[model samples]
Target: MPHKNLKQTGFDEMNLSPDVFAVLQTVGYEIPTPIQTLTIPRMIECKDLLGQARTGTGKTAAFALPLLSRINLENKRPQVLVVTPTRELAIQVAQSFNDYGAKMKGLNVLAVYGGQSYSVQLNQLKRGAHVIVGTPGRLMDHMRRKTLCLADLTGLVLDEADEMLQMGFIDDVEWILSQIPQPTQIALFSATMPAPIQKIAGKYLKNPEKVIIRQESDVTNTIHQKFLMVKNINKSDALVRILEASFHDGVIVFTRTRNDTMTLTKILEEKGFKTEALNGEIAQAARERTVNRLKNGSIDILVATDVAARGLDVDRISHVINYDMPSKIDPYIHRIGRTGRAGRTGEAILFVQPKEKWMLKQIEKATLRKIEEIALPSNREINEKRMDDFKNKIYQTIGTEDLCVFTDLVESTAKEQDISISQVAAALAKMLQGNTPFLPETMAHKSAAKKKGTKAEIKAKSPVAPKQKQTPARLTPNKIAPTEKGMERYRIEVGHKHGLKPGDVVGAISNESGLESKFIGAINIDYDYSLVDLPFGMPKNIFNLLKMTWVKSQKMSISKYAC
Candidate 1:
């Protein structure tokens, strides 16, 4: 009934099984996280525990290690059942059990969730799993079908209990707990103790040991937080500019739902980025593969919903972008926690709209950090960055790669063409660039007022001459439609004739592709369809995908606009 000390402790001091301790060492876990340090020992002692900790505090291992240690591996009849709110968390918990119990000779762990096939789960259940990690709904189904029996169940853990409550699974959770024997050791972990969660705990838990670990806002101190004010329609366009401007090895873009994840992933891929989507709709096996791909550097960007990205740990992730902000503070914390891990400095960028400034203030208060407001990087800035990168690439190649063959060819070409060596080098550079533009035509213009207090303050302070306003020139036959410099114009089938508005087109493309609206250019509605300006170099696959995307009950039929 008493609380535990919040002192730092080592896993070795917790009196865990040697196999479990050895696996922990192998997994690079040295000292226990705060929650783990406080809760693991009590759990090992078979005490009913009620733990309070935020996500990303290593709560999974705190309960998992103790349960695995207590499991009678030989008698395998689902001795430990971990019920999570979402399929992602269930898979994550099962993976943790497998990892912590790796050296345990006959230990079997299986994750059961709604999206997966019942037959697959039944086969694993019949084969006899020592531990089962599952969502409440699927677990209830199996229990009703008599596919999952709890005759030998010894331990039950309800992870993210508040999340389950918010998801309206508290009744199902209480029912599940009722079915388990009273003697079954229960451990409930939640970020916050709402009335409902507490009521459930009071009824179900018997003299539960309490371990409260508050997540400090300073946990995100290592992350450089920045925000950009963008209109809802321009978010995807803004996102593209940010991605092009920033130097990141790996990035995770968090969305609000599964559909957002898919749409954004398609948009990024069309823009020629190596991206993937993670959501509840994806099968468990495919989810595993996608995460693995992210870790191994096959995919540089991942668009995901909060539920799908729960418990995702990939060390290589350098940036976390909140494309669609979370409604709650806890999820915001969890989303940003994906980066700035393993003692590395990371970046967290949030795209805010005029209406969402209140949420921004809430985040600042919750995190106790001042998120600097930043302007969207102009085309000139992106081009400068590209040039710097190109120069560095050549210098790096000169140091690391053998350029003897290429250098000789360049010299021979220069001599044969009677051109200077510098001209020959420039020619080679242009050839290497192919059709890619070396410089962006125009930058996204920033208002003078927004430039205050930023790095552009000096420029804002400087006086400038005013020019007369003039009508914009029309597009010539040889020219692409005039747009904000750096953006190219394309055509989609849905237009005024199809009862499409600019917002409708923006919403469709932004939601479907994850492109920010700011990056999207002018829309000239035509009789049959519309012509919209989009970023150039869209991948063929993405273009095809957009063609099939619907807008106001009509296929987009998107194509490049040729002058």
Candidate 2:
């Protein structure tokens, strides 16, 4: 096992506030991740800085903690401002600031972004915010409205700088930066250091300290990656079976939209597992509560979208399940990156439809990592783990706990019934075996048979054998049947009249459904609406679900193409 990075130090570790240290200790954060160790000191000193790190390396806290320490909590005006490319990310970073600053007295943090009621945001600013985290569009809106004043801003941070550049928000970001008071501190963090970002930093930052944390060359090595090639129909049953078989403790299940995050969480709860949902629509207070539940022992599973999960850290997380794989590579890393933290090995399980394999390739290429596939856990594995847990519990009870009271009661019952010691013990074991499934022998073969091929010499396990034309029994419930194997069409209302574009439709669908944008076929936007070809036989429930989905705040519905 590698040494944990959260506590590993770089500069003056002693400079961290006692409150910050208290929170870290209570949460079991031990070492400083490379970025945290290197960047915290500079940030604490209120120095201009640049940090380059991958998605999962604790960058949020590195900037958040020190910024909290540097700010004047006594001031009601926004003292520190952090700009992210998306509303989800802005919310996430603001929450992080809240988490780390909870121990600090009088600190106020607010997240401002579009897609939410403006009055509520205005009210928050009216109430006063010391730390403001917001997206560019919304920030510009606030600046233009003169509701937010930046002349007294003490610190500014641009997170995921490269993503801002990609989304064509660089000019806005630069303009925002240009308007900040000259004496303010500046910090930027990005996975990739694109030229445009560098130019912005070169022009704005003064004698900035730069820290680039090394990404694991062997991301695939530390992570156990595998995908099941089930069709859309049978996925729910398959997931239940897989969860039972793996016995994962703390799990994160990814879905595409806020509704689906709740949907999956409800499903998992019905299956008898404690679960929670995190999404853009969820209240910020509720989001923090759910994440806290997942971090503590109160909840075992969290179902969330990519945006809802930004800067999320839960050290006990044992598994990251891609109920729906992400289209973007960096976010994929970010999702799976939840587990396998602090040098502890973790598992990543992906569920892929036959059409989504290309996305797998794209993800592999993006991370410069080759993920090995493995067979889904078999029924036998599930039963075996159950038995193991039962046996371990029994052993632990005998080893450490006082059994005198129970033992005396058992003795009295045995005496009253005239039963022997062995029989009594056997009867006790039987009664204790409540809901656990008995390990069945043939169950192991069920999982093994699903594999394509297993190599004896291979170090990383290969993915389960790709589904072969496979039967309908393997399909997931929400997946619709193919209209045509390669292409299909559905109607929408936003075509030429609405000035709809291909990317707009794709983004809307992908954001709403877990399906990758690439899976969407030809899109022809009409005047009022448009028609799009998607995988055939869209699952009735999902189709019904998507019918109410909206793009540009317009209902996205489908019918047989009119034109």
Candidate 3:
């Protein structure tokens, strides 16, 4: 039977190294997610394993923590290779590896993907990297040119295997796997087990340990989930606008870190909202007091971290605001579950940065619901609400109390100043408004137009759009004329007969010189050598580096070539 319902109270039970555990603590993760609990031990044992979980399930840490602990820092050659389906994921996984292994000095981790300067990657590889994270196509390019040597590779991981198959990269993935040495540990993770992915696993893996994570909770049907596209710098302002416009009885704002709770609570309190901070740093008695305040209407807003807010139930909580998106999807489910309880409707508002659309997508996929995108509350809406509230207070005072004294004072002031009663009332209202603007500048106009740009422009500028693939031009040695501007043609010692392709030469030069591929000019294969154009004014150090670089068992022996 597949591993299910494995109980793990904390990460300590996983036996991870102190350094790795320390990183986890700093990241605010005390307990392991289900996938982490099931996968970490088997990976640490160097067993071939399969983990089936949707995105944002802490899969990166599940594999990364164990692999980081086993890294042999003394040997800098690539020991572990991770294959991702997208450059974004490649970068994210690479960063995670770097973060988790931060305590391990001399741990060299590189992320290789298309659209990045090849020169930088090549230089890093030449210097020696212990771990490499990359997308399939770029990894293949590096492997074919032997820039990414896997002879020392001790383990291999295929993250989001199903995505690779869907993106038509399974063949390249397979070719990459074929290059790994025998008896090397392998792990494959995917959300679903389709036939093709299963075939690759069956062929490549040896009695793999399998763990499948099912959805932990169904997002409450009564909770209407929505997201706002806001920048990090503008989130606090946008959050305030949301509070001012929306009608919420009690709100619980979720932040990622303990310090964030304190910071946001201070900001809200300064805004004159009855707000309190609840985090692990607070004492139990203080926390109880804070909760009691929320219960008795002394505090209507509570800023908290996930751990601190666990097991907290307040029926008055009509809204849940994700001030910081949770690192994992499971926490998101729990965070929103704080509201919409007992068959009552609740609202969950997520503040999403542009780079975090991937996480947003993961939340939607896991929840099986579409989170509607909403614009921030407009200026007119906020001002109107404030004015309505101000008017309602005056009307309530007039209806409930004998206002004879206040009315006589207003009449006396108006008669003495020889002004209309309306003028006197307006003066009092302005004084009551104090420094706060009665009609604040429109919010969405300034934030939306200035910070994010127009919607059409934002969509056009979205990084989610796939980058255009560049196909190398086929060239003969004779056609190497009219070198592109600011580019100098150079000749190398290896060509087609050496089993060299255009990609190999480009990868080799780009890797050696740390020059971006876009700056690298044309390439033409001669009988026994190849000619390629590189950026003008090549540095002596880079030239020397290129001369020593190898491709297809041949030294580059690079020298400037005239057309």
Residue-wise C-alpha lDDT for candidate 3, range 1-563, written one tens digit per residue = 24455666578877788888888888778777677788898888999998886654568889999888888888989999999876646766888899998778788899897656689889999999999999899999998998888888888999988768766899999999998998799999986788999999999999999888765423356689999999655888888999999888899999989878877876786677888888765543346567778878898999988767754667799999999988887678768877876447899999999899999999999788899999988878888888787888999998999989999999999999999999999999989879876777766447757877878898888778668999976435556568888888888988876667889887766655657788777888887888898888988877866776655545578888854
Scored by TM-score, the top model is: 1
Candidate 1 off by > 4 Å: 1-5, 231-233, 257-263, 280-286, 342-344, 391-432, 442-563
Candidate 2 TM-score over all chains jointly: 0.64
Q: What is candidate 1's lDDT per residue for 1-563, written digit by digit as tens?
A: 22244567789899898899999888899977777888889998999999887666678889999888877767978899999998877877888798889999999999998757678888889999999999999999999899999989889999989888877899999999989975899999987889999998999999999988654523486689998888755787788889988889899999888777777776787676898888765545557778888999999999888878876878799999999877988788878988886457899999888889999999999888899999999887888888888898989999999889988998899899999999988887889877756666633223433545566776688787798899965332223347767777788876555567789888877755668999788888766768888887776755655776666545688888776
lDDT of 2 by residue, 1-563 (tens): 12235455733364877777787777767767667777888788888998887666678888988888767767789989999987667877888888888788877899998755688899999999999999899899899899998877989999989878867899999889878887999999887787898999899999999887665533344678877787654776777777877767899988888878766666676677788778776544446567777878898888888877865777888899898878777667778878887567789988888899999988777766676766667766777777787788889989998899989988998899999877898887767665543455564555765563455535257566767795543212223334556566788765554446789889767755668987888775555767688886677755765676655434577566643
Ranking by TM-score: 1, 2, 3
Per-structure clash totals for the candidates: 12, 37, 4
Model 1 lDDT, residue 277, Cα = 84
Q: Cα lDDT for residue 91, model 1? A: 79
**Which sections of candidate 3 miss by over 4 Å?**
1-4, 217-563
